[model samples]
Target: MLPPLSEKELDRLEDLLITYGNDYSVLNLAELNGFFTALASSPTTVMPEQWLPAVAGGKVPKFKKPAHEEAYTALMLRYASQVAEELGDDVDHFEPLFEESEGEEGSVIIMEEWCFGYMRGTQVAGWAELPPEQDQLLKAISLHGLEDNFELLDQMSEADIQACVPQVTEAARRLYRYHRLQD
Candidate 1:
């Protein structure tokens, strides 16, 4: 079984985000905060070269000194799944309504000047993703600054993960948004 990624092993992910993430990601708070904790200690385990999936064709994209959208999204999906298991099956569906809105952005010009889908209505498609209010379901996460496992943070024992719920949703949504890349 793949070991639960140690705090250190998971850290390489932060570095990867900074090196290959985009502008939107650079502004994220989760990456910055998470990286800080990881740096506090040395890796109890060594990071294998294959730790991360090969950057297809080795054409790695350049990002800022922090994680961006992709990292955020991955974080969320993971949290959602984990939380679902912990909270029981009923909670998973409301964990986060991850959706994709790429070319569809600005498709609805609400006042001809203000749009909705970019971030505002991203959660509305199937529903929205807002943070700070965890009645569950955060689709277009306004909780952007988070990079820990938030889903079960409040309920877990002290030794549990930090649950970056917003990031998890973003990653799930992004996968669908960029599905064409796979084609």
Candidate 2:
């Protein structure tokens, strides 16, 4: 198994992505984590060639040096592998990397970016029409991730959104298990 990235390495990767510029549609660390998680949980394997370009917003970045390119690719692949292993080995304990902010009510989990990334992963995987039961699992992620749901989400109180956090997490876990069972 590939070694997991160190905290310092993760920070470095995040910095590298930012340096690449938002104009390129680069994903931040939290979003990347969510993206990887979704890819890892996908019923079908998504090759790097298929998803790497998606990471760079449809165009692969031109690295300044071969070493930089190698390091970046290695880090991303290892991180993705780690996510797959984590979910495959223990779906019940899988935890998403969500950002948190201090709201008036105290700390609030920011699921938007992560969920958006996950939804992107599902798209990259070209998910087929799922059964209603499984579709609900995907909807949990979409409710927070998709801009189309913004109006519906707006109607929810902070507490309501907070309450949905566990549901989202559980939904992801269940989705993973459901796909694994199909294998």
TM-score for every candidate vs. truth? 0.26, 0.94
lDDT winner: 2
- Cα misplacement distance, residue 166 of candidate 2 (Å): 0.4
Candidate 2 residue-wise lDDT, 62-92, digit = tens: 8888877887788889888988888988889
lDDT of 2 at 72: 78
30-111 in candidate 1: lDDT tens per residue?
3332222111111122121221212211323443434554663454334323422322333223223222223343322111
* Local distance difference test scores for all models: 0.30, 0.86
- lDDT for model 2: 0.86
Task: Kindly report which residue pairs in candidate 2 clash with one another.
Answer: none
